[model samples]
Target: MPEVVVITGGSRGIGRATALRFARRKGIRLALVARDETALAAAADACRARGAEVLTVSADLAAPDGPERAADAVVARFGRIDVWVASASVFSYGSVLDTPDEIVDRVIQTNLTGHMRAARAVLPHFHARGGGTLVFVGSLFSQIPGPYVAPYVAAKHGLLGFTRALRQEMLGHRGIHVRIVLPASIDTPIYERAANVTGRTPFPLPPVVSADRVARAVVRAARGGRAEVAVGAAQLVTRPLRFLAPRVFDRFIWTLQRTLGLRHRPAADTTGAVLAPMHDPGAVSGGWSRVPLRHPRSRRR
Candidate 1:
């Protein structure tokens, strides 16, 4: 039987690349899910051109039933799901104090709750088959605290806890596989979306890896059954910085925010078009893009 794989946020960036890569592999079926119908169809078309079975599900994973609907749609079409990849995420960058309650809530509900819901929806099917792999497309922000994007950082950090707890619960469980892939920065539309929230440009992390690189890593994790993998040096450095100087790191982040003129904009609500102090996505291609380099928004000079 061809392996059936479900990928959220499959319209663009790493998710799209992963779906495309898997579609090219023989004996692999794909279900692509995202909120954008147009992007999802485009992604599905690309995957279909590769001679792989492809289904596109347009659903908001942040809504209560969005995850369930996406999972059910995939299972209904493919019959069985061999892999579930949670890649759909909303990016925001702003001070917790200034960010609206709605933004904060939405971020958690989408990034964390959506994953939980998707996993729950698929676990039964996975167990029924006696085995399956769960791949989490988490960010390096999950490991370290970022200054301006407090809500996003918090959600990512919470995901790490969720990942670890779930790992402990599922380890050695009959044929179940769970893993996390942390990527520092990849060139994607996510940067632009994040800019809307944080008013920042999306740049590579001084040496940004391509979305293809992260996609390849996802494929490798799915094949090798690795517990966790980090895709870039930005994560490599940030992980240790958290442990080495916790207070200093926080202070550094504070100083950077102060120095970069990046702070919560004076706005009553962040729901609509509110011009907030923003920074670039920070070297998403790992400093390889044409965008001019700027000081870190979360780090001091």
Candidate 2:
């Protein structure tokens, strides 16, 4: 029997790449969940081509019930889930003062609460089955903290905390594992969208890691039961700096923001990038404005 893996936010960016990586593994069944039906179908098709059983579900993780529904669908199709990866997250760039309340809510819901929902939804099954692997796609910001992306920073930190607590709870249980993958910036649309909103350049993190790099880490953790992995040397440095010299690091961040003119500015809608505030309806463009997106069919193949 093939091992079943359920992944959220599998339409694009790291999620899509991760799905493809897993597809190459022999005897792995993959279920990809995303809001874009078109993109989900495409991702599923690509995975299917690799000889894996693939299922695609169009779901908005930001919604309260979406994660449960996605989980149910995965379980229904696969009978059992051997792995769960919470890869769905959104970012809003700007100062804490400039970001709208709704955007904050959405970021929290999608990045933090949504992840919790998935964990809770599948944990019982994992526990009943005597073991499972839960992988979280955390960010470097979780440890280092980034200015002008306060929401993302907060959500990542929350995710780290959640992962730790979950791991502790699952400890001593045979066959159940929880771990996190922290990576520095990769060349992805998420960065472009964030840069577009924040009016900042997406530059290479010192020893920046690629999405594929993170995907490999995920694969190793899933197969070998590693507890946690950080993908970049940049993260290796900043993770400690954030703890030992938080104030100093924060000051440096503020200086960078000031030097870069990255203070809250309205994003231009022309870039096809999403902004914060209204997260559920979907991606938003321009400053202080949110564009609601209806769940679309899978668009990535």
Candidate 3:
């Protein structure tokens, strides 16, 4: 029997890349869940081309029953789920006070609550099977919060707490594993799809890692059952800095956000993909590599 994996946010970004990565492994079946039907179908087709059996579920994970329904459908199709990847997330760009209540709630629901729901739906199956892996695709923000992304930062922090607690609960269950992969800013459509309240366009801090890097880490976690893995050189340094000098690190992050995180070019304030599925399905990369990296001082001049 093949290993069956169900991945949320599988339509694009890290989820899509992870699906493709798993496709390379022989005898792996995949069920992809996301809101965009077109994108989900495209992802499933791509996986199938790589010779992996694929199922696409177009469901808004923020919906109360969405995660459970996806889990049920996957089990029905594949007989069992060996691994579950929680990677679906929506981005928000604004101060907590500036961002609308709806956007904040949506971000929290999609990024944090959705994962909880997925876990709830899968835990019973894992208990019955006597073994399974759960991988949460978190961010470096899970440790150190950044400015102008209050909702995202909060969600990541909550996710980390959730992962830790769940891991502790499964301590004696040798067959069950809970893992988390925290990646630094990856070149993904999240920046484009983020709800932007700032007058300027939102951009990730420099040295953006590729989605493939994060995807590979997630795959490794699933196979190795590592408790937690943080990807990227920046993440390595940031974690230590955060621990060594809390206030200084906070100031540094604030400076970096004001300088490198936003561009002066005016962009119309829109909810991006937080509220609705994007009309055009996104790919893994946001093409940030092509954009020249500008220094903060250079932007001012």
Per-candidate TM-score against the hidden true structure: 0.85, 0.83, 0.95
Off by over 4 Å in 3: 292-301
lDDT of each: 0.73, 0.72, 0.89
The TM-score leader among the candidates is 3
Candidate 1's TM-score: 0.85
Per-residue lDDT of 255 in model 3 = 89
Query: What's the ranking of the predictions by TM-score, best on top?
Result: 3, 1, 2
lDDT of 3 by residue, 194-283 (tens): 999988877888778899999999999999856999987788778899999989999998888877788777778899999999856668
Output the better candidate (1/2) by TM-score: 1
Reference-based lDDT, residue 266, model 2 = 36
- What digit string (tens of lDDT, one per residue) describes model 1 on residues 1-301? 8999999978777888899889998878999887777677778888899988888888877888988898889888988889999888776656667677777787887788889888888888888889998899888888877776777778788887888888888876777788889888666556444533455443334455678888999998888656889888777666676799888878875675554424333322233211221222211132233342442432432
Q: What is candidate 1's CA lDDT for residue 181? A: 93
| Cα error, candidate 3, residue 45 (Å) | 1.2
Instruction: Report RMSD for candidate 3.
Output: 2.8
Question: Per-residue lDDT of 1-301 in model 2, one digit per residue for the tens?
Answer: 7899998988776787788899998988999988777667777887899988898888777888988899899889889889998888776666687666777777888889899989999998898888889999998877766766788789999999999998898877878889898877654446444423454433223343456777888888788756778786666566677688888877876775555424233345222223322223222111110111111121121
Q: Count the backbone clashes (under 3 Å) in each candidate.
A: 21, 19, 0
Instruction: Give the Cα error of residue 294 in candidate 3, in Å.
Output: 6.2
Error of 2 at 257 (Å): 4.5
Pairs clashing within candidate 3: none
